[model samples]
Structure formats: C-alpha cells, structure tokens
Target chain A: MTEHVEAKSATLADELLGVVQAVEGVSAVYPAQPLWQSVAGAAVAAVTGEQLPLISLTEQDGTLAIKARIGVGSPLPAPKVAREAAAAIRRHLGNVPAVVEVLVAKIEA
Target chain B: MKTPGDALECGHSLAELSAYLDTGEIADPAHLDSCPECQAGLASLRRLSELGNELLTADVAEAGSGGDDWMQTILDNLRLELRPGRSIPLRAEDPQDTLWETEGSVSALIRSVADSFPGTAAGKCRLLGDITEPGAGITVDVEIAVVYGHAMEERAAALRNELAKMLQVQTELDIQAINITVTDVLELPAPAMTPNTEDQP
Candidate 1:
C-alpha cells in the first residue's frame, strides 16, 4: 500500500511537470522555486487560509512570469495574468533572468 | 433518494428534460405529465439551479472587497518588481562595469507598492527620456485603479506622496517629476447582512 501511494504521488508530480512544459514560450518549468514557493504561498494564503495549489514561475530574458489556467476568462481586454505574474517575479528578483509561472491544475470538484 | 443533480428516470430520459429546459423544445411534451420520474427530475433540477445561485452568492461574499485586508496582505507579500523597460547606463569608476536597470523592473515595483495601499492599485507605468545616459531628465508616469468608495482626489494625493517617497528611497534614477492617473474604479462589495423582518411567528 505504501509503495502504491508513492507511485501515485510521483505520477501526479510528473503530470504537473508535463502541463508546465506544454505552455508557450516556456523554456523551463520545474518544481517550485524557493523564493516563489514561500512568497506566492503567503500571497495565496491571504485569500484562502488553506494551502494553495502548486504554482510554477518562469523567466524570459530577465523577465519573470506566472502561468495559471483558472478557467474564468472574462470577455474584456485587461492585463494578462501571465504577464502580471512575470512582473511579480521581476519585482522580487530585481532584473534577474527568471520567470514565475503559476499553474492552477485542479479545483475542488 | 433524490440528490440535487440526480435526474428522475420515470421511464423517460434526463437528456430530453435538460433540452426542454434550455430550448422549450422537447420531442414528446405529452409524456411529461403522469410520469412521476420526469416530474421529480424537473423539480430536482430546479432546486439545484436555485442552490447553485446561492452558492455563487456565497463565493462572491467570501472573495471579499478591495478594502479588505486579505487583498492588502497579498499585495504586501508580493513585493512586486519594477518594470524597467530599457537599461540606462551611468558612468562608473571602471569602464568595464555597467550600471543600469530595466524599465520593467521599476514599473513592477511601483505597481506592487501602490497595490499595497487600501482601495488603490497600480496599472501601466512609463519612464520618459533616455535613462541609459547619465544626468538625463527622467519623468515617472503611472496609472492606478482605485476602489469606488474612496475619494478619487484623496486616493491620488496619497498615492503621489507614497510613490515619491518610495522612488526616492529605492531607486537612483534621475526622476524630474512623478505623474499619477486614476484609470479605473473597482466595485465595492455588498454589505454583509441584509435585513430580514419575518421572525414574528
């Protein structure tokens, strides 16, 4: 039983990695970064007391960005969340060539 | 037992009933009557729809308002980077060393700091002039979104003061002037409790 559970966890992590790799302009998307994991967790916790879904941040040419598929898209022109997330990473890292991408894979069904 | 989304199978189909609700065009309208299953399914769907609306209301309530501390806390934790678009170079002691920051980085920092304030959020920010050249005249222009309840003039005034202080402390850019514009007004959340006067029984 313990072995089975471990396999399942590994499979889920792989699935998450696969999703991150699929987004456009994403050179690399791996497990959470130390800076982002701590800070993003705090930001999410402010809205929801519960722990948040794992969000991945990416970097592009000294610009940081986040990728999240939240499924709620309003039909209006506004600031893209992906760019905003990238901006957040840039703000934290100070012109580092790193982008933060937030992937919201699952929601409570 | 009738669950919320469960369809009643009174020798009829759930799909047909669902279609009827949307288009009012069912193949056999006469079969709906005298069919206990069909009636039960319709009632169940109706109840579920009502409950869904209630749930939506509750969710919006839970999201809270811009004035709420949850948003403030999130903005505070973000510690957003500034959006420095172009690298402005400054003369340094060594010719090999380069002193410059991107426009994207500076803008992001300005936004995050602006968003930290209650009833205020930052938008697009621009730096006018050749920042790469040392001693060049530079102007900081920023757009902001303010929550509806707060006075626009008051919010803008507060934002200017805060931005000036933050820029002076954080960056070494040659900022000649700081311009702020309130571009959007966020809707305020509804009051917590609505009056109910039917407790006389």
Candidate 2:
C-alpha cells in the first residue's frame, strides 16, 4: 500500500477507535490484530514514520475491514456493548462499504 | 517476567504490569487505564494474586510456615498467557458486521459473581461447548472455595442460581448447566496435619 493509503487508513482507524472508546461500556481498547501484524506494523511505522493505530484497518478486495478489540465494564453486558460499538462504527462509516468487527476481549472486574 | 516474550502487544511487559499491581505505579497510568492489554493483564494478575494468597495461606497453615517450595512452584507455574480465551458469537444487525465476546470475559463475569459472596472465592471457570456458535448448548463449570464456616451446600446452591441468572442476562449461550464445584474449604487456621505414618516407613 502507498503511504497515502496507509496514512488514510491509520487516520480512519484512529477515528473509529475514538468512537469505540466513547461508547458507554467500553473501558479499554486493545490492539486487535495478530502479534505478527503488530510487530510488523510497528516496524513499518518506524521506517515510514507514520502513526499506527491499535485498531486494525486493512483493505481487502476493495472493502475496508476494520477490527476493534475492547474491554467492557459493569452496568452493561458484553453483547450489548459489542453491538453498540459496531453500530456506532457503522453509523460513522455511513455510505462507505466496509466490514466492521468488534471483539469484547476483556470483561472488567 | 522470566521470558523475552513477556511483553504485551502495547509494548508493556508483564513485569511492569506486576509492578503496577504492587506499587500502583506505571510509566503512564493513563495509558494503563485506556489500554485493553494492560487492563486484561492487571485483571489476570489480580486474580492470580488472590489465588496465590489463598495458596500461601494454605501452605503456611500446613507447613507451619510458608518458607517452602510451594511458592516457588506457583511462580514456576506462572506461565501467564493473555486471556483472550474462546470467542463466542454475538448477534449482529448488519450482515457484514461481526461481533463476539471472549470466553475470558465471561469467565471473569462469572468469577466476579462468585467472589461477591461473603465467604467465597472463585477458582477456575470453563465454558465447555462450541461457544463460537450462536445459541450453542454450553455447560459452565466453575470451581470455587468457601470459608470453613459457610455451609457448602447452601453456598453452591445460591451460586448456581446466581450464575444461571447472570449468564442468562449477560450471554446468548444456551446454558445447559451451571456446575459449581466446591473444590476447597478454607479454614482460617488449617487443621493440624497428622504426622505421615507412611513417611516413617
């Protein structure tokens, strides 16, 4: 991917991350990609001097695939939190054709 | 802390997390609060700490003093793994949007329920079934320890009722059973262990 595309993706990832974090039940947002991806992404970001967001954004087959891993706290169940987060992301996406996934990786104590 | 790969995805080490638990100090406290990896690590470490204390209490009670290898054994067994656990599918409004909850989170929720009891502490929890499939039949197996004075049967029954209600509200799984196993009965002063006659032989 070109620097412009990567930068744009990172920017959007950061935006979506903000949206997810603003959700009522989400207490934390984790780096959602695989370990190898995180390492490689860090390396790539270092060489290119770009800010790599924790949320993963990959363009596949012309569809922007976004994954956000989050931790939800009490007063709201995880399923509700995950759905709300995904819906918030979708609402932000608007007309953009993309696949959004949310994982409730931790339930807070 | 013993391994090179002890670092979390967010570039924080488990040792650092352990320190945060002990000293309540980290390079970036705000980051620890916002970072899911650190939060997960802290939650896990907290659970381990509670269980470890209970173990040490048991050890001290049995050995008359816990200056023994049992603590070493616990540390050796610390092979801590990030608790993403099994992923259970969730209903999504959009066809393309996928959402799921980790088994670790569910386990944490269940353990919290158990720990809320006056004289109970939660042990390991298992969600036995195809959690990846929505509405799949599953059995929740929770191991717990109760204070010596608490009635074991009553505690287990109350825990069962609470877990069923909580799981029904929190998860979408078709919970076939919520099994509460009272693995240990904790006594403030462990009963004196009789001398091992077999050791004499």
Candidate 3:
C-alpha cells in the first residue's frame, strides 16, 4: 500500500532565499521582489512611488536561475563567500537544474 | 537579420548613446540632438533605468533593515578578513608595544559620518594619499546619493565639515581635502498614513 502525500505549493524563489541565507559567510540575503510588488510599484509610479529583495529567481527553458546580492561580513573575502553561497544554493535545490549567481553587494564591518 | 550591435537607421547604436550618457562625450553631440532615433533610444534607456531603481528599492525594502535576521545570517557566514591598509602609528603607553589604526577603519568612519546626515546615503569612499606615513596628506573622496528637494550644495558642505571635524578628533592624519560627489538624486517615498478609525458609528 502506497501512502499519498501532498506536494507543497509555493515559489521556489522564497525557499532558495531562505536556503542561501543559512549559508555561512553570507551577511544578508537580498529579498526577492514579488510580482504583486511590481504591479503595485507600477501603480504607485503612476501617482508617486519608490524599492531590495536581494535575491531574484527566474525560470527559462525549464532551467531555474538564481541571482543573489548579499552583504559580506567585515574581513571575509567576498569572492570566496560568493562561491560558497552558490554551492550552498545548488545543494539546497537538489535535483533541480539551476544556475546560481551570487554578488557581494555590501561588506559590513 | 539585424545583429545585436547593429546601428539604428540614424547610424547611431544604442551602445554609443549609453556611453554618451555616462561620459557626455559623444562623437557628434549636435547630430545626437537632431536625430529622432537617438532621442527615442535615450528615452527608452532612461525609462529602463528608472524601473531598475524602483525594483531595487522594492527589493531592499523586502530584505528588511541591516539589523534584521536575514542580514544577521549573512553577516554570520561572512568571516570578513580585516583590511588593515596603511596603518598610522599611535603613541603607545608602552614604547615596546606598537599601535595603529587601519585605513579601512578610516573609510568606515567617513561612511558613518556621511550616513549620519538625514536624506543621504554613502557609497564608495576612498582615502587618497600615503596613509601609512604619519601626518600624510590625505584626501577624502566620497560618493553619495541624496534625496530629491534637499540643497545639494549645503549638504556637501555640511558633510565635508562634519568629516573634517570627525577626522581631526579621531585621527592624526593631515586631511588635505574632502571631495563629495553627488552621484544620484533619489526620489523620496510617500509617507505611510494610518487609516482613520473614528468614523465608525
């Protein structure tokens, strides 16, 4: 007898952001911009408006791409931190074909 | 089949206009003003830039403040190596023990000073000159973004004075100059208003 389980319903972008934040050497994970925010921002701009979700995810050709802008802690090498963050992202999204790009936006001392 | 970098019918490419925007040194400034194609391209680029800024603002807002847990987690992972640039020697109580402050610290101090001012955000900051040598003449070059409607000249002057005073009090280096460049003018967000609840009868 096989037990049926319900698959979770949510965008992987948020999940990816949380996973990236958990990785060591990352000072801050940029928040992912939501679609609603974009629509609202457009409406706001029509009147008067102003925005970082540091992480952005896009899916193209069945391949997921993740872009994360992170703040590195004072004294940590940014390149190394970025590399580790990318690797952690891949690990977290196991079996899902993904391209992860990490950018060190700020260094916090 | 038009290539990606193909020139527009007016003979000017998007790349050229983008470069013109940055350096303001185009091959034919007069022609650019006269050309309809270039004008259209410039307008499109400007719109894209505006949208980009809005997206960035939204993303940052969602990320929460610097002290938030998301930021804290990233900070924890980053074991940043101290950038001890040219160190200035300090007068130590014990002659045998050497003391000095890093150039990185000075830059951080400059950033903090600029950040303390209202409606201003600090960007890339640099200390130009030989900082390792005691009493070395240094120039503080800071790039900042200001909110719209603020007096740019006054803000720059105030920042310079504040930085100079802080440097004088905090460091022993000779500050030759403080150069503040206003790189971007940011739009202030609309103030949040609480909904009126007294009308419910």
Candidate 4:
C-alpha cells in the first residue's frame, strides 16, 4: 500500500523572500509587483488589513523560479553583488532546482 | 488589425509613439493630433505606462521602508567600498602626515542634505568639473524625487540653498552651480480606514 502526504504551499515564497533579504550586499529587494496584484492587494487590504510581499515566484517546468529587484550599494560592483545574491537564494532553497535572477535597480550611496 | 510593435498604415511605429510620449518631440507633432493611427498607438502606450506605475507602487510598498530588516540585512552584507574620488587636502596636525577629503564624500553630503527634507528622496548625484585641483570650479548636479503634494520649485530652491551651506561648511571646493532635477514625483499611500460607525448603526 502507498500513502500520500500533502504539504501546504502558502508560505514557501514568503520564506524564500526572507532568506534572500538576509543575504549580504543587497541594499533593497526589488518588489516585482504586478499591476493586477496591486489592484487586488488594495481591495483585499481594505477588508483584511494586510499588505503583500515584493518577491515573486513562478513554477516553470516543475522547477521554482525566483525574480528579485535589488539595490546595490555604491562602490560595490553591481554585477558581482547580483551574482552573489542569486547564489545565496539557491543555497537557501536546497535541492529545489530553483532558478534565481537578481536585478540591480539602483546603486545607493 | 494592429498588433503591438507593428507599424501603422501611415508608416509610423508604436516605438515612435512611445518615444513621443517620453520626449514630446516627435517629427510631426501637429499630425499626431489628427492621425488615427498615432492616437491609437498613444492610447495603448499610455495604458501600459499606467500599469507599469501601478506595479512599481505595489513593489515599493512590499519592499517596506528603508529601516526594515530586509534592507538592513542587504546593507550589512554590502560592505561597500569608500568612493574616494579626487583628493582635497586638509590642514594636517603633523607636518609629515597628509589629510584630505574624498569627492565621493561630498556627493554623499549632497544626498544627505536632500534626503533631510520632508517628502523628498535623492537619486543620482554628480560633481562636475575638475576636483583634483585645489579651489577648482565644480558644479553639483543632483536628481531627486518629491512626494506628491509638495511644491517642486520651493523644495528645489530650499534643497539648493541648504546644500550650498553644507558644502561650504564641510569642504573648500569652489562650487559654481547647483542644478536640481526633479526626476520623479511619488504618490503618498492611501490612509488606513477605521470601521464606519454609521454603517454599524
């Protein structure tokens, strides 16, 4: 006989966002807020009094893909920081076959 | 019969319309008002721009304020290197030891001054002209975003004066001009609402 177990997926993206945010050299995480989500979030917030998270996650070809917008501190090479951030995200999501992309939105001094 | 990225029957492309929206200096500004193709293209681009703004607002809200833990962690990891531009010599206590302030520090000073104002955030900043030479003529160019509801001209003038004072007090560079550009105007978040007492009644 085979048994099946189900795990809730509600908080997975949020957990990933927290981990990525903790990575060093990242100034600010780019919130990839979609237009529709903003509208929906406003409506929901009016009722539920909750805000949305900025990080976005998508499932593609059975693998999780994460996209983040980040600010790089001035005097640090943006490309290098972005690469390190992506690596940190992958390290946190062990064995998940995740793809991560970090975009340097602004260079903050 | 028109798809995005496709040129209109009049031979003008959506790309032209997008550029026109940004620069407002199209080749035929008068024709734009009368051409149906151009009108349609402009309408589509405007809708897209609105959607983009909405997305940015949502993202910024989600990111939280500058003091949030997420931003803190990123800052902690950064270990940013000091931007020491041209050296500006300072009076040294010891005859042998040399002291100087960095050009990067001046830029930082300008940014801080702008940021101190309510409803304003500083963006890219530049120190133009020669700074390596002592008493060199310098031009300060600062880009800033003002929150909605603030008077732009007043804010710019105040920031300019404040920056001039701070720079003079802090450094010995000859500042010839302070140019302020209002790059963006951000919307304030909607206020939270309380339960309506009238509705309960």
The number of the candidate with the highest TM-score is 2
- Candidate 3 per-residue C-alpha lDDT over B68-148 given as tens digits, one digit per residue, 9 for 90 to 100: 332232122111111224555434332222334445445655665675676565665778888777777988888776656
DockQ versus reference, model 1: 0.04
Q: Per-candidate DockQ versus the true complex? A: 0.04, 0.51, 0.01, 0.01
Per-residue alpha-carbon lDDT of model 4 for A1-109, expressed as tens digits?
A: 1122111233666776777677666656545553233678658855785545556666668777676655555445444555666666677777787666554443333
Task: Give the 10-residue window scoring lowest on summed lDDT in candidate 1 chain A.
Answer: A70-79
After superposition, which runs of candidate 4 have C-alpha atoms over 4 Å from their true positions? A1-109, B1-82, B91-97, B188-201
Clashing pairs in 4: A24-B77, A25-B77, A25-B78, A26-B74, A30-A69
Candidate 1: TM-score of chain A is 0.31
What digit string (tens of lDDT, one per residue) describes model 2 on residues B1-201?
A: 345556654677778888989998888676665455456557656765775576566553343323433333322223223445677899998999899887767776776778778656666677888988887789988877665668999999999999898888777889999898876665556566999999895
lDDT of 1 by residue, A3-103 (tens): 77546544544454455444333333322432223676557655675433334333356443443322112221111322333344344445444433442
Error of 4 at B38 (Å): 49
Tens-place lDDT digits, model 1, residues B1-201:
434233322233455665677688876565454232344345434433443344345454243343334333322222222111365443333232233333443554465556556655555567788876777888988776555567988777887788777655444667898888876555545666766779645
When 1 and 4 are scored with lDDT, the better candidate is: 4
Clashing pairs in 2: none
Docking class of 3: incorrect
Q: lDDT for each of the candidates?
A: 0.46, 0.74, 0.56, 0.57
TM-score of chain B of 1: 0.50
Tens-digit lDDT string for candidate 2 (A1-109): 9999877887898899899999999987876864435677668756896545768888888888889988887668778989999999989889888998998877754
What is the docking quality class of candidate 1? incorrect
Candidate 3's C-alpha runs over 4 A off are A1-109, B1-82, B188-201
Native-contact recovery for every candidate? 0.00, 0.82, 0.00, 0.00
- Residue B99 miss distance in model 2 (angstroms): 0.7
DockQ leader = 2
